[model samples]
Target: MLRFIRLIIYAIFSFAPLASAAQDAQLRRLDTIDDNRGWEAVGRLDVDGRGFCTGALIAPNLVLTAAHCLFDTDSKARIDHEKIEFLAGWRNGRATAYRWIKRAVVHPEYVYDGEVGAERVRNDVALLELHHPIRNTTVRPFDTNTRPREGAAVGVVSYARGRSDAPSLQEICHVMARQQGALVMSCDVDFGSSGAPIFSFVGGEPQIVSVVSAKATVNGQQVALGTQLEVPLEILRAELAAGNGYGSTAAGRVVAGSARRADGAKFIKP
Candidate 1:
């Protein structure tokens, strides 16, 4: 996985570094309610009690994250969705809202092959439907936007390994390059940052442009890699609408919330 990630970074390094002035933003913890305002939708995803990744609410009940987060890190087998939980706005050991994933749908092209590459990163997106909708006064879902261009300014908020108590915000980061459908940015991200949303503040509103997929180094400079959300996001949404993902009832049950259904337990299309 590490080697393949390096390869992806290397291939895009010629255009990977942004201006030094645009690369110094640091992660600031959003530990207080005031500090966490407008970002209550970003959450920590607990997958099957084994490990965690970052996720964010995109709708009343739909949580967006990386597809790889649902697979076991060791055996590469799919993890049971029943044990997964979404802790929105987690801070001081608590969350603004807690909900269990009723079902999840990964991008049709994503696969957890224990390796990473630009192609793999391009398709690394998923959507999990919560058992109940989160309609809070403060915890509002964010809107999605088109892919960002190189050198575009963006920001990210996420819960990582050492900063798991609350999600930290990297207020300013530059998109370094776009290779195929993958994006390389100068954002600070680590393991738990996977599925963390990358936001573009156009028109004074935050819209999701990408999600952290992997971290890599190019010429000793670290960078965050992610997928361009415009296409894969729609794909996952369509899959969920078709009732092809795992539903809230059981492992094999699939429901499009109120309409469609499937007869299998598999969440990812084989």
Candidate 2:
């Protein structure tokens, strides 16, 4: 009788893993941005036409994204500011607003070569100043807010590898954990989704609370990682205002870390 009970317990645990995987597979892609007017503010940051990362307009001329997006993966050097462009409401080969980047500022504490960790991810946020402000009625910038508590409901709008031409909106994801300035969420994100905005609709309209930095597998489930934007964003804004946060092409610059996809999980950046 005891032996029979053990066998049943093992069988039940085996099915638990399958259930988790099913949940992650439910993320859907937003094929059209017609009804997603608010999502128009979220756009793709094309890096020298070589690669892309997701970014969102926080101010008229200021865009927020991941710091790693500013570095070249091969050269490990800072890409020139003139090489980047912001495509607001990009979908199906069309964009609502296209603007060139004039300047950019990464978190002062962010180290491009540092290993992925709580501190590194926490400081992975970046701010880009557009050469000209996006002044269109359809392409309004989003507002930033304080980080949400653990277990809070959130959403993410991004452009990823397979769905590169169009952006996707995951309207329902939850913050699984919040520790050391990083948020672990159940949101579905993949390559090219880096720097995507994580929003909370607590009061009414969606407000950006975090920015996607990496995607990882926690336990038997896949999850997305994000940087809490409250403090780091303020610091970056100040640094840019002081003209001290611009990238340099000096030698020995650290390259951005590549995405880790060995354990059925991948970092969502180039």
lDDT of 2 by residue, 34-142 (tens): 5566788998777765678899999988999999888877777888876677888887777788777777898988988775467777898999888778899988889
The positional error of residue 148 in candidate 1, measured at the CA in angstroms, is 1.1
TM-score of each: 0.88, 0.82
lDDT by residue for model 1 over 1-270, one digit each (tens)? 567666766665555454442654888999898999999999888665466788999999999999888888678888877668888998877788888888889888887883456778889899999888999989999999999888889999987777766789998898888887988888999878889999998898999999998888776778888999999998888899899997657532223453211111112110
Give the lDDT of residue 2 in candidate 1: 66
Candidate 1 deviant stretches above 4 angstroms: 11-21, 250-270
Residue 232 displacement (Å), model 1: 0.5
Q: Pick the candidate with the highest lDDT.
A: 1
Off by over 4 Å in 2: 1-25, 247-270
Cα distance off (Å), candidate 1, residue 202 = 0.3
Please state the error at residue 131 of candidate 1 in Å: 0.6
